[model samples]
Target: MKKLMMICMSLLMVIGLVACDDDTEGMKKVGIIQYAQHPALDQAHDGFIDALKDEGFEEGKNITFDDQNAQGEGSNAETIADKLVNDGNDLIYAIATPSAIAAAQKTTEIPIVISAVTNPEDSKLVKSNEKPGGNVTGVSDLTPVEDQIDLLVKLAPEVKSVAVMYTNAERNSELQYEIAKKALEAKGIKVEAATVSESNQVQQVAESLVGKVDAIYVPTDNMVSESIANVVSVTNEHNMPTIVGEIAMVEKGALATYGINYYDIGYLAGKQAAKILRGEAEPKDMPIEYSSEDKLEMGFNESTAKKLGITIPEELLKEAKIVK
Candidate 1:
């Protein structure tokens, strides 16, 4: 009888050890789905991971991260989302409208946190900003359209006609174009839109606007942002001044940009994720937050400016972050 009792105690100890192992393995797992590879998106991801670490969820320790990039292909985004879901990630962090849409369609139960999305409502990912009314909520990179238009008028006083280029298929692009048209029109600047459905069409659209408009404005549309180099080359070749939606574009070649710091926006999203993880708030109860501060940076490519025979405004130069 004593031997049997000792054996039973040993069996209970083994079961307790197995239970502890299961609990340890059930630690939080997160998956990040990025729409494309770009400086802005990269910074946002960095900020998010940094925020997670700051909150004590270090990757490969208490948490695991599965990062995937769609490489600018929408179909690839869907595939990545499926894999992440199959992997049973506790949460999914989708960075951009396309990525968010892909993840949202893949799972209704998994909590999705989207960052750097321009217009969630227009993307149909949410019913409204006030109440996302779904399993998704995060930060927006919504640049002030009216403020950007005002900056353009100030930078180039002689600018009469402004040409805007974007991808027509992207809902964010269409939304930004509408805002740009109204804002520029209010300033008595005639706005012309050049739409492209693919990357190959970007150069042609940029070429079509050469010598026709005093300045060109490029919004934070994913398609246009991804093909900015091609558009910038064409615009520079034609000696046309360009305004951009994000500072990264300005650093690339644009004359000036009024937009948000994407990294900070990502950090904000990370904070929201922490809240969700702590069970402090529900996704539907959380409202989509916009960047509180906007940054105005000038990228004066002296060589490009001189090559185009355009003089950089001294006042603007004084306020510029980079004077090339």
Candidate 2:
């Protein structure tokens, strides 16, 4: 009788544990914090949602999303991150470095899947890229800066000197600028640089580079990308060819770039989020992912090319996506 009672109790405990697992069919809550409203970040956010849908976590059916935007403010990102953590989110998808840093700071318990962050370790969101060692893991949007510099030279052989403009506060932009500077110098191209602390200062800073350099190279800095029209206004008037860090920036009027697709990286991050939500994986165990180089695209601006009176190489034109 005693043995039968113990066996019955063990069976009941096992049933309760299985029932408590996250694999059970239940509604999940996901919080998304986007750092800004630019095209790249917007596409990332959209792709993240699409990936969740494909993973059987459709909004309003199995999952509910608490989407918040920081509007390019660090304080706002922190506030939103706090709210999401307090709300008991099943998982958090942070778009951009600022938002990811905010979410990682808010809670170490909640699973965090980040996108658009250039360096997770440098940003202190993860201990390392291979093994995150914490509750954060996602994709990095580290575009090929060396190849991009080479592309700039190919498009405009006359560019002997270039201006590198970026936002000072963005760590990702700062890192890319350092890499770009080295690459430019290696090709015997002189490099001038400028930094903007805010969007309102972009035009003035861009104007400062007018007579100093032959062309401009802008990285995937959120603040600079948001105010890209201002930079282009100056470049267009000067007939200067600008090489940007990503395709969206090319679409915004920069000359060209060998950049990764923000949507693809975001989709990869979303899949990580899905695994966490279903209790199939833990953030610390998942290795950080990157968009495959084969997925990189050469993007050029048609109108900008014509405006600058630059001739496109037949080989490049054959493989590039011409954005008018």
Candidate 3:
């Protein structure tokens, strides 16, 4: 009789475990990986979470998230992707080009959503933007680089030479550098470029541009964006006027940029994620979205301009967003 009771107790324990497993069957798991910490990327991540909530996937209820930040390391990004995919995450949101590519490389079966990538095709993270042709699709923070350079020219009319600095390892920054170089050259301005592979080199690179160029320009580079304060430190000491690809950089001391709203792009990516989670769409069928042209806006930092001894035109200041 005692042996019989032991068997019944073991069976009851198994039933209890099975019931607990069944209770979680209704919840969805999402894995999010960010390339680094910066205002633009943070805004994108926040927007994505908010949009997911808007789509009825509330945190701590129907959905759970495994969020990881790569801290600007490619190897770390790959490891994070592997853990998220191998651990059976239902979806992945990659917050930058490197993070997106890492997630894409980790699994083809898991639905992967990307945000803040400039050229998805050029990065080879997707087959095409219109139709992903694979398990990766989302939003692009493709700011108008040419228009930004035009605004920079107008902001610094007497600038005859400009230095473009970016992380050499990031193709997104390289693409912007090419555009900035071409635009400045077309206007009879000499263009110089400095490339850094990581954050430690940003100060050296920014210092290299001092006394060599009339102004400095930076694109939406993950590495550079992550270490922009260091760049600003060097540039500010030299009284160099710097233009950037995003408004957040203006707050960090870049003189100006006419850029896209990163938050909106991330929210759009979350919408695509919601559709996939709801069984209404697939990543392969989702077309990547570009930040609308209407969302592009001008920005400038008065403090940085003042330190650089650059005068902002009253008209430009009136229309552009002031970065405090």
Residue-level lDDT tens digits of model 1 in 182-210? 99888888999889888888878888888
Go through the candidates in order and give each one's C-alpha lDDT: 0.84, 0.91, 0.89
Question: What is the overall TM-score of model 2 with all chains considered together?
Answer: 0.92
Report the Cα lDDT for residue 212, model 1. Answer: 87
> TM-score ranking from best to worst?
2, 3, 1
Model 1, position 58: C-alpha lDDT score: 75
Q: Superpose all Cα atoms of candidate 3 onto the true structure and report the RMSD in Å to 1 decimal.
A: 3.9
Candidate 2 Cα errors over 4 Å, as ranges = 1-25
**TM-score of each model, paired residue for residue:** 0.90, 0.92, 0.91
